[model samples]
Target: MWIKASGRAAMLGLKKKILEQLRGAVEQAQREGALPPGSLPDVEVERPQNPGHGDLATSLPLRAARAFRVSPMAIAEAIASRLPALEELEPVTVAPPGFINFTLRTRWLQEQVHHILSQGEAYGDLELGAGQRVLVEFVSVNPTGPVHVGHVRGAVLGSTLARVLEAAGYRVTREYYVNDSGSQMEVFYRSVWIRYQQVLGRDVEMPPGGYMGTYVVDLAREIHGERGDHFLRLDETEAIREIGEVALERMVQAIREDLGLIGVDFHVWFRERDLYQDSAYQKAMSMIRNGGYVAEREGARWFVSTALGEDKDNVLVRSSGAPTYFASDIAYHYDKFLTRRFERAINIWGADHQGHVSRVKAAVVALGVDPRLLDVIIVQMVTLKRGGEVVRASKRTGELVTLRELVEEVGRDACRYFFSARSADAQMEFDLDLAKRESQENPVYYIQYAHARIAGILRNAREKGLQSEEGDVSLLNTGEEMDLIRKLVLLPELVETVSATLEPHHLAYYALEVATAFHWFYDHCRVIGEDPADQDLVRARLKLVEACRIVLARTLHLMGMTAPQRM
Candidate 1:
């Protein structure tokens, strides 16, 4: 059941047979003593970054020259003569320093453009993931308040990464961890109480370190419920807990809505309160202590994290016998790895927790879990900018922007695109005005416009009674068309590389490359109203254009971006 040498139908539109031919030829050279046996390292083949250097380039000759005691130029000459032929990759010339550059045959590239049109939406997906299970946890903000813009970047990042992973053949679970413990929850309760009193028309000021947002005011009014007047005289602790519970639920609902607007939907909503109620942390602590991984110091229980590369011991329980936030994390991670047995667990955290990474890893290692099975991605800070001024994240009592507010201003698409457009390890600025623009200056709109244009062309082609069958592949031989073809053909490599690297930004960059190629082809090549002799060429060109559109559509889709058929 071997596949045929179909023109442009080569697997994934690559010259697979030709690559094998080249490999065989190089080996033949070694066998014939034209070059020393095993002189070259593994046939290192690659597409040159700069087109001027030719199609494919390899440094094998130079690498083996010193070992073989022969000049690199001579070694390259021997290999070139014995080299097997390839379809598009014409082994053109050996440059200085043992670089073998290549030139792709125009006919082969033209055929690729045709192949792309014929393939349509099926063009780029190569099924590389083969359906493995991958769980992604992100934007685990406490339910004390609405999600601030500070949390938006990671939300977009994790959701997009999940989409990318799914496209690459992994079944992805997107989860959000709700922190309902620690002093933060207490702060939340207090804020709700203050707001409840305010709603009841009390003259009391908010606590010294408490939220001043109008959201708290809304929560208080909801809780007051005609007892609005009685809330002012109610006991502080009772009022705080009541307000905290109801307010926490409302805030989580708002966050879900905010995420929903941006196309981010989570598979699980895990609460930290559930962990404590189930006694998971107590069991984890007891197991670690009995397992001899915990010790007592200064009347406090400390985990022996130093054995797993941590600098010092971390307190598992304070002298007051209450566990710290780290204790909850240990239990949560244990639940994920030990109880769930999810193959692996992935956490997308914010820059604020940068210091916790090492300790978390150490704890996982100490708990007898393979540290390699844990993946932690920290999203750097994002500064919201409007009118050339830095907008701060309102620290409960200060002026700031919530994620929902930002999404309302620009849009979900712009927010997701802007955040996931760069390396997650670096900080970025969210230009509010620029993202809201309808112009090409707005990248999401720019990419969407390209998709829309192609759709328009196709729709009108049908209405105008144009014969739109995929025309002859031989008609598309121009460099611009071939360039577009080559870029489209590399979709599999792009997806696989980005998935393996865990970098969704690479897919964003690929979208831009495909868009640039299509735009260039669109400007230079006409799609209709030509002479009869050029009729087939028009069809072929349109087909190529359609293929580009499909790729642009799907790549953006994988990124969870809307590829609009019209702006």
Candidate 2:
């Protein structure tokens, strides 16, 4: 049920209202002997795919038919006949195969414009989460280099989901897990040390599989400028350790700045090394071992994943006494679920990490936590294109395109919109030319232009001394007006749907639909006109346009995009 928490009682949206009515009508039918008394199935209400069919439809009768031992059509008719009259809806109708459809009255939708105006920025806010704690961990890219295009998709998804959850009344904590305790950081540290030697005029060959990006050399140069030959005085081991720590700090700072270019910020920057220092790793391993999920094999400790129905067992610690990345993940989740006690933890990882999902869940269960508390969203890679040709590397650095560069070229709004326009499971191609285009073909521009157009109308009204607050929403009776109002009232329900599904791409698509409806309404109606006698109609239309602006702006804000007042 799509319910929102109000002051003392739950505020029911249109979908929830329909569901309640359907359940009540079913009970009334059973009491009146129209249908057999039996257990009722879960009733669900959904928007009809065909607008002409009705606004919302349900299959409750079909679901209950077997239990009641009645024809679905007869059950539907019985339920429809017993339904109480709802002022917000037109007459309920029954369709073939036992579908009950409900359509909102045109006048009801028109009145919602005033309701939206009264709510203002609070129109779409929902309390569905009821103050539960949720940790959204994403973009935990190895702090080896700048944030590349491959990582930005997950970054945007995580940040947008965090925002949507917050608007739905969840206490959300955004986090980035810094993989500083792994072999990758070891390579990054050595790569920086070698680069420092090279910059100081030492002829040295880089290690096998060293970081070859120019950013590493730049890091070496910056270090040399600040502390010239300072590391040369220390022993090589000590010098490497110090240089690696400094390099890691610098890399993480760079990543933070790059993500900030697209409006992503994290409440927590968790270090993998902390798991060892704080004994979280030891605690997690102890719990797993006590649960008999750990075994000794091949001179190393192995996680007995096969016992948990996995195809193969996994090594927890190598023979050399070093923990694997999988071990680090188990410790991290222990901290998330047991130490911090978040009700739910959402991890957004790149597609490359898809294989680790089931194992992580298995590990969580080994630690005595419910596996359902963890959600892993794998975001596929992003392909950059320019003029329909694939763009592989940056022209300036000759490496993967950085998030900063993308934001600089296309602006932050375009970067966020395009990244969020696609589902996390699908690979998306971000077109540079289309993103920067000023025309309607660009969804970012088209949506923002609708808000800008509304702004212009309101500005014109104010200049003419026409007060929209005094307008009668009842005067809004045109088909276009009702259609626009219909779109406007969908925001609250959309918030609940996206919150429940944890899919933020729906918000992006909904924003576009709202923009399309506003554009259609504007083409057919005028909010500001020349004749004095048409002023009443003008005022009413202005109120509706203002409602459109509110909903559109709220949608953009939730997606972390700007609602430009002017093109």
Candidate 3:
């Protein structure tokens, strides 16, 4: 059920209108002593899951029955009797036992076409976020190699979520956490050094457990091309660290370019080394220690997570006096919430980090920050297939189909649409053949075709001297026209829901649904009628068609995909 805040009353949709009416009715009942004068149950209005029930349903009666010492049906009758008559609602009634149901007026639904046209590209923008500051961190790949297709899910999900949040009125900051300090980074650097030596006419084997990627050799060749044998005169320590930094920069640059191909840009690139170099790591440990959650155990500093009901305590620093990556992560979040003062922070991690989620949440709680403010979205795996055959990847050996390759194979628009068309928690299959198809079987094609079809209609209408903005939208009373308007009116609600749930997959579903509704209306109705008698209808329907185009374009833009005017 949807709850309406007072400030958002003017923007309430049909469902929220019902919620407001129910709230007014409850207040009236309480004033007249029909119910107790105390805290009332929350007013929530929702679309009925089962279509036959009603357009909107409320469980206010069931919630209030126990509190008011009355049967559920009696409470519902009392509330229903006091409901004010409104033109926006039709056939307000009570269902069996407790639920209150209401259907929206068809005229109101048709009028929304004009509303959508008036708003244009801003039709679906919601005020749910109310400008709260939020930071979303994702695709913080190890930077040991090129960004692979394996990181695509979190990258797409996080970037789409950021866009949706911004649409919902949040001040969003997209961030990439650079893992520049750790054992993995050390191995990568040493591997690059060995590759550099091999390119210098020296037969050197790569160190055990170092990077075996072919890209490593490429990096070495690139360095040798720039600085021919100059590094050979330097000491081993200085050469390893300096050469590794150069290689790391190249890898990170490659990652950024690949992400740019898919329209992902970060507002901040936070380095992990900054945590220790800037004393932030010590401050975080100090805060946890003052919160009484830190203790020395087994020659190591532990977080004492067992006190929070965990079965085991996790070490923050090892016995050798080196801090773990977990410690750096705690410092990172501390910087996000306490230093930068972001109201909320979201981290999109791979499924392999599921165990780390609870540990991080515990750290947040122990650091005196509310754990609820931090959200960790775990993105599952993605399997790429071409003609039903699996495409395998191995980032360790650099034998991987990079994200750039995926974008190039299917085009940027198709790649973003397909990657974002599923939930992050759900494992997805990217089928290359279907994505390349230009028919209705491809969803991206189907949606883009609808937009293009509407564009063609509007173009023909203009050539016939019909002005879209000059049409009287009130003439859009046909069932198909009403259906398209209803679908257009749902974009705001979808934006609000996705923003609140931190789920952007709903946008993909809503885009397809909008495309389907527009196609249905276009199939049944003609916007350009040759007969002089139907000119008014043609003009009015052209305006409606233009509104559909606005919504479709806005939807695609939100998902970082293109809306083709001609296909």
Candidate 4:
């Protein structure tokens, strides 16, 4: 019952137990008058950097020393003496200058191998979110072209973050904010119209700053094949309008297909046009205007962002009476916060949108929402690599690399893994040759191979009529066995950490560590021993292997990658 309750507490079971003990000890010490107590600071626990120190450590005594007017070592002694016994932890230690260290019992770590097997796929599931609703909007490239390589990072990051949040017990909505209105859409419409004319053998020049990708030509050809010059007879205005609607639909579909190639999907495709419907845009503007953040200067509507500590004012609507992209963004967030009423809205934007973060948060504040509820993550650009050279353009299209092409080359698993291998703020280099490699040099292969190896071992045990369910896990006392169990138990903790920080890259690194640990255990230990006398050891090791498999599979799934059963 305690294990089940602890599993729901996000599997920081030992760490949490230590924290509880420490807090209780502090209270006991204060009541005993061994330590002067005003209100104690919040007790925090962390894993020590060096394994020799302990499994988990806390500097609560040091943090509370000044407030209590006592030396940290004195406080540590007082608390450590008062700490109640826990079966999962060995004797607690107090280090110099006041640090309380806890080492997990070896038998307790061994028992977790069985516990993890009981959890199976749900081993890492946590109650950290407690069912909070979160909306993660990402990879909202304009519906004017196919998704490019530059957009893949945020797509993978946002999708994986949504998954992690779900594992942490949060109800999450994945959305794509389609920029299907305003000047960009007008340009897109004009560009598609010119391309359609070219497809129809008409002599029409493309407007300045028009799309030049070969996909546009392909779109034009498809439209010609479908419509057969019917739009050619319409007046130029009507033709552009009709063709633009068709083009936008096709482009949005193309964008969906391209993103789907890398396993990115959205629950909602929120069009910018929707913001203007039912005077939603006007209502959003009115909220900001009433907050006294809107200003009229030189025939333009400006958001007085300087009033909210912004370095300069921003245009909400131009002198020409057209709203700026910033205005639509404000309306969009108003929908997310006020209309939809998400507890939190996380926007994953490209590096180019970094400067817009503060303004949007400022606008949220003016709209009577807490600025902290809006989190804007700026994902840096990605550079594709082959061998040692930078990959700039698609060889077939002679344009920037498309997300579809990247997926085709490296595959969906590698695309997700490599895109999420780095923090969102760091530019990543995706190596084509390495991603395709079948050897351990590739982390994707290495991690999957660990799962595959466990699968193979299980298959072998079944052929030999072995039953791991009856295994005595107490026999698993090897250093490598305990070490691997340590990694297996970290998944719930990882989910909680990533959910709080909104960073999914740590999952990649943790998967690799689990793989490395499994590899080491496999190298040093034999699962199915040849001698009949070693059957107990064989069964215990089989249980360990099975636990490792569940952990590896769960980790891979969270990263949006496949956990192959066979290499």
Pick the lDDT winner.
Answer: 4
Better of 1 and 2 by lDDT: 2
Which of the numbered candidates is closest to the native, going by highest TM-score?
4
lDDT of 3 by residue, 1-567 (tens): 222232322235555666767888888888998877666678788778776676678999998887888788887988899888767677679887899987767766666676777777877777778889999999999999888888988898899999989988999999999999888898999999999999987998888888898888999999999988877888999988899899888988888988999999999989999998888899999999998889998999999887877778888999989889999999998889888999999999999998999889888888789999999999889898999999887655668888877878888888888889888889899898888776768899888899999989987876777776667777888778876876787778778888888889888888898899898998899888778888778778888888899989999999999888788
Clashing pairs in 1: 394-400
Candidate 1 lDDT over 238-264, as tens digits, reads 767766777788888988987888888
lDDT of 4 at 396: 42
Ranking by lDDT: 4, 2, 3, 1
Among all windows of 10 consecutive residues in model 2, the one with the lowest summed lDDT is 1-10
Off by over 4 Å in 4: 7-10, 67-70, 393-398
Per-model TM-score, in order, reads 0.90, 0.95, 0.93, 0.96
lDDT of 2 by residue, 73-137 (tens): 99999999988887778999999899989888877777788778888898877778999999999
Candidate order, TM-score descending: 4, 2, 3, 1
Please give the lDDT score at residue 170 for candidate 3.
93
Question: For candidate 4, lDDT tens digit of each residue in 1-567?
Answer: 657657653248667777888888888888989987688798899988888888888999899999999999999999999998888889989998799888888877887887788888888898788899999999999997888888889999999999999999999999999999999899889988999999888888888788888888888999999999989999999999999999999999989988888788999999999999857799999999999999999999999999999999999999999999999999998999999899999999999999999999999998899999989999997788899899877534428878878888888998889888899988888888898776767788888889999999999999999998788999998899888988887888899899999999999999999999999999999998899999999999999999899999999999889888788
lDDT scores in order: 0.77, 0.88, 0.85, 0.89
Error of 3 at 290 (Å): 2.6
